[model samples]
Target: MREFPQISYAFAYGSGVFPQTDGSASRPAMSPHPNPPEAILKWQKGGGKMIDFIFATKFTQHFHSLNLNRHRDHYSFLGSFGSSIISHVQDDWGAGAYFNPYITVNGTLIKYGVVNFKTLLRDLSDWDTLYLAGRLHKPVKILTEDPNIRVANQRNLLAAVRCSLLLLPPTFTERQLYTTIASLSYQGDPRMSLGSENPNKVTNIITHQIRNFRMLYHDLIMSLPNVDYGEARALQQGWMEDLKLDRPMAQDMDPAFRGNMVRRLPKSFRQKLYFLYQRKFGISGREFEGMLEASADEDAKGGLKKPVGGPFDRRVAAETDLREMVLKCVNQTVKWPSATQSLKSALTAGPSRTLRYLKEKREKGRENALCDGTIVALLGDEGNESMDSSENTTEDG
Candidate 1:
């Protein structure tokens, strides 16, 4: 859209994408972080920090080559070597994204990660790394999408709803639901352990960017078979739902729910979980697959045909097993590989900078990872509300 290369999908995220807080039509209000520090508020006015983006391109190597030809100076000495090395490391070792940090594109400091369009879809549907999945769970601006790709991604949004409802308690607030959804990809993430960001990071994202969270998930929330919004519109203060979790009805429905979630996972991931499900509870992959296909057939008959229909069924033993396996699979697959990518990252970062980069993560993690204050406040009371953009969103969003 901005004369960028052939991108199938792209988004601008973080404070950089946020509009100025002038509350005018052209400039939207800031996200609701009740008591943000002064620096954050200042940054909302328009910060000079590196803007972040996730780019799903037509071809990783071609894009990289084009980018290299145009902005040769953006990369470090090694980036000039070839695009092949970077593409291999991106797909084979690390999580799918191949990030080039601290590149100045036309005087604006930009950081972007490139991934194959196919890989992006898989991660969204299957929670492959939950790297992009996790990021997508929060608010982001969608720049472009192919028609079929946009339709396929609806399942990803549905999966997020189902997963969130499964883990949520019977009675919870809107913020609570989003917070749980936010925490899904972080369950076994090594970054959380290292204190790379705030333990309150997910909650903060929900509270601050409450409008985006609401706009994205509202349709999914309403689409649930067993919840009612009563009087509240999609995005409003004091919104709640009535969830009826009758245990017997829930148990009958568990198989369908389990099947849906398990089947949506990546093949290798699903296979591993399938074996474990059989070992623990004696349910074969075919049985699970059967339920998923049957359930899908229901969407046409006013959505997901079968029912013990509660917003979702109760969490069952198999669901718990699948959740554990997904965490283990994603964490193991991405953790060390990301570290390896970090090592290669030093190619772009000189000796002093590389050391500073490593040190900053470790030191900052140590400082913020264990903060006790943010923990207690999460469940206590509602904080003050902040501004949010109220424009209606479309699939293109």
Candidate 2:
């Protein structure tokens, strides 16, 4: 195992930690191939994609200072500015992360990002910047663990589920649900628009890591009173199972339920949603905030306390534009941070390495576009009809 300085939390993700592929659902059993998976084998041999890591540290300056002393080559010209400046840039800059890409460790090319633990936790819980929070939405290989992050990430996952549900139709397939959930962070990401990322990135992630997604969300899905499965037994056994809406859309149509969903969203996101709500519907922000505060107070009481729906709840239920409002909120929340992070990466990774990374990404995007377009075209109108029929049936149910 590779050695590194002590850190609060660390994890590996990206194509290195988890290989990206399609058609996993239809993949043949290993017996026919009788060989180890190419991706896994390559990773084990340290010859595939560069392993990506994120390290969360208690003190940003101290950690960078130590890391700089140990691996001075990991940093670009920024090392000349001293650790204090590097730490300041990391904490105050885009998404509170500083990445050093194209570094070779133990003869294996690796890219690692450093972040302050406090920033990571806050973003996980409140989405102050969806940067790190977005990464945690997908599966990762944990190298080190912190209890606080584990708990905060649970809340993050729950918020993702609720957000996806609001944006989805009354009825959706398991694949569709996971796809939507996985696509949350990329909603307004500039990379997707600029062709710097795979057009089918979300689909690729869902197809490749469906089982991992299932493992992450299974227990949470089971606990939700509003959602039900067409095959509960199979679902409980960790198999792909159809989702049957318990009501119009997996939850009561009452404003209370939707309001509660909004209540539980990340703090920064919820605040943005509130702003959108007021802008579009002209609702009083004070009243909405008050209801949220009251609901939170009740929740803080811990024991069973019945929630009484207020005017804000009714307003949320009555608003025909709630879905659009949510979409706008998400887009706004993701847009700035994502753009800023890309710019910040240029400095941290240096111009030469940044150009190399962009070239690789663009090539990958081109390949993915060709593949994804064909797949979508093959699915054709049948997929749309199915979704339409499901929605109609759900509305009637």
Best by lDDT: 2
User: Each prediction's Cα lDDT score?
Assistant: 0.54, 0.69
Tens-place lDDT digits, model 2, residues 107-162: 44578899999999999998876788888888776656677887888878878888
User: Which regions of candidate 2 are displaced past 4 Å?
Assistant: 22-41, 44-47, 236-251, 284-310, 369-397
- Model 1 scores a C-alpha lDDT of 0.54
Give the per-residue lDDT digits (tens) of candidate 1, residues 61-101: 88878877776665566576788866665667556677667
State the weakest 10-residue window (summed lDDT) of model 1: 371-380
My TM-score estimates for the predictions, one after another, are 0.68, 0.80
As a whole number from 0 to 100, the lDDT of residue 113 in candidate 2 is: 93
Among all windows of 10 consecutive residues in model 2, the one with the lowest summed lDDT is: 370-379
